[model samples]
Target: MSGKAIVAHANLDPYERTIVVSDIHGDNQGFLETMRQVEFSPQDALVIVGDLLEKGEHSLELLHTVMRRAQAGNVYMVAGNNDTIFSEWYNDEVTDEEVHDYMNHRKNIILREMALEMGMSWQTLEEVRALKAAVPKRYAAELDFLNSLPHILETEHFIFVHAGLKPGPLTEQDRDFCLTAKAFGTQLHRFEKPLIVGHWPASNYCETIINVNPYFNRNTNVISIDGGNGLNRWHQINYLILHREHIDFGAYDALPRFRALDSQEPSKDPLTLGFPSTEAEVIRKGETESICYLPAIDLEIPVANDQLYNYKGKRYCYNMTTYCLPVQAGEILACCDVEPRGLLAKRNGMVGYYTGRYEFLSSDDLLLKKEGKQP
Candidate 1:
């Protein structure tokens, strides 16, 4: 949040593929099980959605796995609110004494209260305690890596946020803390591009999502993969895969080489959100097509030497001789060009343009429902 030391990654191509995981909550075994459910390849990208620490067994092991994957050039991490808090304490951004006091005095009661709220029974509460006792200290290098995490990751087709963005085009000013906080029950719409998130666990959405992670906003492009794991009695671990090309759907119906080593089992109910069971099926499905409800209206008026386009009281000029207009009124105007040179347009005399690399999406092509307008 403070420094450019952690420069966020943004890719112009929205269709770029990746995977997301959430709220590991320190169940290393659950994390491994979740990984087993999804198909991973050397070419694929992996992202940890957040809540990677606190009140879970083998927190250190989970961190180690993240580090290992990152070192192997496939994984990325965003700091969840809890990740941030523990990290702050771990890095002395929050005092060690403060965390120690909380762990000593309020840890058990707090775990029980949260578990009850999350629907854990007394027996499950013991599991949470057992998980806590199994927790080990984190490595210093991993803390540095966590501290260096990005608040947002952008691809050509999708964006991954720790929690959810505040809405609208992402900007540097979007606060990191808010980025990782809760967004329950708000009528938040997914971006025109897909948004992947993890924080809240999903118990009811299994057959669709495979674990505790909720898939509520998948229809709208907001996927929350926090399958509560150690935090919920359900004890599901989950992540998702997006593919460049479609794979077979039949693979999901087949059993895996390994069922979960833990007590957690798949729910009897069918997953309502349409998650493919195995990685191959996800690949076969390709990327989900995003529907943008926003319409495009082009304003053009013919003129001899120079012509102008106006929309919403704004004016833009196109020169038949030298340049194309970059904006018509308030709407963006794209340049038409040949292959040797891509789209070229000038705005406000700055001569703005993109060549060979820019991929433009028409407003009509966007998943353009206004924020808070979608279910």
Candidate 2:
């Protein structure tokens, strides 16, 4: 039951257009707003590549939305690693260490979110055990929704899976492998058709620049669409629209919006970005922070010292960043924070640092502006 295939097939022939997005991770407003921006309609097939739940503030709400939309029959979901996390735990498929890792790794976990919704809490193992007992009855509807999700949705032109596939026919791949495969973009595979996947962020493969647009590896015919959502300061919900063999993409973020009043040239110096970051090796230790080496750019930078660790004899920080982005005026950017050093922002769907003046957008309208980039 754990490793078997739960394949779901679709032709998508009836839909006028098809839209694919991945790894929303509970950014319900961003997902809904982007749906509005894309002008999604009932005539369209909305294919979510996976990781729909967990790691954000609104998993339950987002789940409700997807569930409601799915009833209309045009919406399809491919089970993601996170999407099946609930079933994994409830079924006792994970060890205690795995449970600890899950608890410590994410903030705003969906299970805890659901537990809170049911007037319960899960900060410790005891609470989790109690919730496990209560969940089958109390959270039956949500659990059924999660359990019923398929791992693959194959259409005529594309194979939509949350993770990568191994070589073979669609019916041959394991459900868990399809849901948990890592770095399928890097592997060599002879696919029957073009494949689209999430789980691994597109940012991981963008070495020279900070980009999160849907990545197409024409060599292997695999497209990676995870946009670093729910995992970093710079991220978006990436959309991939399909029309026959042609493909189009864009990204949306829930970050604070800013509009530029004046233009500035990009940094002339050679800069390294997102060599698939949020992980780095420590080069030197300091009192409050550590100097770390990012392997992708071969650059060393300072990181907070508190999180450095050794796993299986290799050193890595749980979180790391070396983002420096270019900016332009009159365009909107997703602003992360304003520090004395500079402004942290993401523009044109690329996440990085910007040292420029920008105007803030009113949260309600996203149109009003005020001159500021200073903290």
Candidate 3:
């Protein structure tokens, strides 16, 4: 089958609390702190909504923790998009050429760490490539654990998935969509039970973090808990605590110590994602003073001719020199006027940037756009 089946199920006692988290993205400190705060015990149930690896310095540590808890039968996990990518590598489903391509696209960090732990110093690209070839043989057990993860988890009153499900009977939902879906049509909300998903951040559905105390929803019943954990400056890791009668939020401040590891050296040139040289030249020549709207904050902010400004405590500037602007949901940012070269925005605080026009759309609007339907 193209998508994995729902491999596990659980029936919680009526009085037991189920604490669920999504998109940990390898923040071991944040995960540990959250667990400590919640006083997570073996008796209490913990469900993680996937994306347990990548983009952080402690990917292996985080995976070990989850595997240990899971083995004890206290944790249930549903695979996220990132988890699926690593699974492919572990299963030997990808060729060396395919793995090399993925490594080039800023995905070598995970493999490099694994190689180091195996007593190899992969200091060069070629060494990293060599390590990729040995992954399936060296990490067979770990790969098996990742492959065994289910796509969905269900309770009498709630559905736990890595991503939102399609609008219809739960049994009929596509496995791939449940693992990686970011936008869902209103039809998805018509289902009888509330859904909890994590692939997309809560910022995509709400304009501000202050407004997300209750929950952020593309649909009223589909609550998203991905607090752009490792991806954004302003947002922190978010966890949702579910009770029989109510839900609560558990947020951990970003670990500045760990976040510093992700900082990059300043780039002299503007970052462009596959834009042709000729097209980029045109954008620079035609760049003009424009007022770009901050859809998340519902405010219109003016971009200077060629300077950075502080919005919501973060600095933003339009690179007339380059077409890309580093902006994500829930942050106060100055929008750039790069129409032809395309704008860069962060999706759920993921490592890579998503290239698209400088247009803001909520998850619901995004669903309509993807479906070729009017909202």
Candidate 4:
């Protein structure tokens, strides 16, 4: 398929609502729940802001689900960065050498996991090449659908794009600006239309917004609805409802899970695990006791002889053999510091240092905690 400009105009009646969502990344369950919560009907329009494929396990399924919906009702999608990359691969813009290099040496654990899910063996570059060759054949329909997606969709009151447009009129914007730009150079109030986007997570701009739950930039007329789905357990699928003269927010719960392949060895590569690196060495507190960070699992696994060490009002004792502790997704950890390292935490009952951030906390649970209520 050749690159083409797809600009769709949605003409809706007064009672119809336009629901926009972004960055699904293959969270099929979350997407279904969002649809069910809204009680989606034939009258309501659905707009996806991109990054629909990759990362999660059910990307192919999610693509089919959206395609089916598009046939039945008004549904539109903007091509995202991941969609662009996959398009390149499908259109032969991505060479076999590049795929080989990515599979063998690239530090992108998510991509590697995705390749494994697509039937590529993790052992060799030849397997990567085979998978690349077979993808176009296996997912020809999906690839064609992805390649056909537009970069921008405009209406009378709103400009819906995967990311943000460049610093000019919509007609003058390029594909990169629409599909990949992370931030608008200036506030979009000059355009006189609200620009709905998904790419940057709402949590990234939480500090600046009064209601961080749905991340809206009132000054710019830009609304970001990506809840970081597929990034971790803390994020969810967020949807923005555009009605007559108003916009509302709806979120669906999305919990992170260990990728099928990564679940087996959750901490095999500490450097490429997408966490910050630290140089703090293991210090031996005394004989048969050592305070150390395990590179395999990205957690501080303290070792003590038989007595407890009191530090910062938390008691720590060695419970298992050194370098044997394992960490997985969905495990709750009480952390004292949000830093990548140097955290005093408790999992179950044992006390140690947790390296993961509270950013992984569920949004619904966080709201309850903030309101002094139990979830």
Candidate 5:
């Protein structure tokens, strides 16, 4: 009942492989498909590093799926910051004013969705109290699963936490920090084993290029596997698989696949590899878009100025890419964003702006085209 750090030690020897994933953010389909791509089996153990219950379209549904799987066994989950915050609200720890603000921009919140499903609303204090009690009683299993989730999962070779950790004894680490650690990847920590984390997307750690793949910092033995799911359409669920002393990563998303129709031409100007995936300082703020400079890569790019305010004194650009894409004929990619600048596409885990010819590599599109109709 007292929201605190519950560190758990895991033994994955029984399974043929130990699969680690994080920041699922309620994308149940993407999670399942990523496992399918990796050929997930009963023989494999899955460790969802965290953020399993919020942000995507199916927060509560994803929770049920994870609950069912965990009940079936071979599945372990850690508490993400979103899960922790929700727990705090549910336990009456959050003040009325705080809850009001939290529920203000209500979108994809698990608790809100659960209440809505039962024809309940939390706009008023009476409604909040009534639904809070009713929700847990009706969905006792889901609540219990969230309540029982650990903040950290440890093994001989790896230490899995939703967010990052402070360098020290695992038990003494701050509960909230472990649940919502920021920039833990950049922080130097010499753990005996590799520390795997989510919450913070792996691409944000990249300064020069856009890579949603797991980031392995050999120097610190820290591996970040949050592939920016739920943050944007381009991002996907990153899977970290450990098998036979080898570690690999895979990603899956809901974006439609496509193939290049023509080869890339030579660029006259300098090649912009990609935009800075992390934070950037605002240089010129525009009405619709602002120019921000990312000190990590010394690149200035235009970003959507759609935020009402900054969180934790940190600002981020959701859409910022100036790199031109070069694609060979037949190169496969997933369509991410489309703009007058070019089609923003991700190929081989790297995202870039493509001006070249391309076609949707989908049967649905083919079917529509075969009927002589524009899709």
Candidate 6:
């Protein structure tokens, strides 16, 4: 997950609002252009949904721009699947060569296949590899920030997630689904809030289904701001503005400002999972004596520390402790670097903070029975 900077007017007068965007995908130039075109006011808050790299010519440039925006306290970002892959590689967990291999494979297979389906000239593996090599080391912080970012954000009236929730026990999975282009069908009206997603490219036939029509149902808020960069058909970026009262939109009709950082596609996995969802849960029935466990992925084994039990599961690694609350199924937890701080989410309810993993409850089976909870 990347760092987010919130910008709002001190008074938040009637016109003050936040602007949300989907999948910049390295279109930093377009992003700036769109902001200028929309006459972005300092009073506005800009939130980028994620997937800002991996398919453009100005990834590093875009990264610098994003950091400047954050530093200026104007913009924030949620980690997209594409951003996840770049983060791992930026952290050196995945090498540049390995990324190139994946991109070459994707180019030769998936991308080419899609191009053929669309009757367009296929982008070659060489072109993709070159694009990856073009990424400079200057964007390291931005990439790390992207990797460390969260999947969802909450405001007074709306909730912003890179990907929407999935009907499962995993919270990250839902976010990942919302960050990709897989399901833009007849089932877009399922979510309760105004879901702003990017990842899926724009399509004429699927326009109504893909993008949220906030005008029809002021309450039925669903928006897809990815204007489909990196293709022969479209070259625009959409920016959405929303606040307590209403919402609006803007678009940038220029080429992308950055290059793809690597050939690897975004990570398909979501980052939020494994914990409680409320402050009350963290405060509930905690023992005086405390222990914590940081869960591990299948490849990483959990190590016990004090009362902490680092639980390595089939999917993700999480921390568990006696001080931690029992985790209900479908809850996603993100451990914080700040001592005694971790984020807990039950389905999609309000996100909560816990002191340690001891508060996590783990039975052989945990069942989740909610549509969406907080943090």
Each model's lDDT: 0.46, 0.77, 0.58, 0.60, 0.76, 0.46
Worst 10 residues of 4 by lDDT: 257-266
Q: Is candidate 3 or candidate 4 better by TM-score?
A: 3
- Return the top candidate by lDDT: 2
Give the poorly placed runs of model 5, Cα more than 4 Å off.
1-4, 265-319, 363-375
Query: For model 6, what is the alpha-carbon lDDT of residue 97?
Result: 68
Error of 4 at 355 (Å): 18
C-alpha RMSD values across all candidates: 22.8, 4.2, 13.4, 12.4, 4.7, 21.1
Clashes of each: 19, 0, 0, 0, 0, 63
Q: Flag clash pairs in model 3.
A: none
CA-RMSD of model 3: 13.4
Tens digit of lDDT per residue, candidate 2, span 88-135? 876778854576567656677777776777898666777767777787
Worst 10 residues of 3 by lDDT: 274-283
Q: Model 1, poorest ten-residue lDDT window?
A: 250-259
Give a tens-digit lDDT track for model 1, residues 1-375. Answer: 342213367442243446567777766666666565665656667777777777764666667777887887667777777666534543456544454455555443333343354454334435544433333232347557767777777765666676667555566435553354564314356558766677655433332222332455645666665655555222445556666422111001111111111121222322122111111111111122111111111212222111233434543332222222233233332232221222333222122223323323433322123232111
TM-score for each candidate, following the candidate numbering: 0.50, 0.83, 0.64, 0.63, 0.84, 0.49
TM-score for candidate 1: 0.50
Tens digit per residue, CA lDDT, model 4, 1-375: 333345666664443898889998877787899999988888788889898867776776787899988886588888887777666765687876676775566443334555556756745667766776777776677668887888888887888887776556666667766776764423455456778888876645422111214566777777777767776424567888889557888776633211111111223322211112222236556454457564545676544333243444544432222111144645555432121232333333222344432343545433334222222
For residues 234-283, could you state the per-residue lDDT of candidate 6 as single tens digits? 34566766666577665555321111111221222222222221011111
Give the distance in Å from residue 25's predicted Cα in candidate 3 to where it truly belongs.
0.3
Which candidate would rank higher by lDDT, 3 or 5? 5
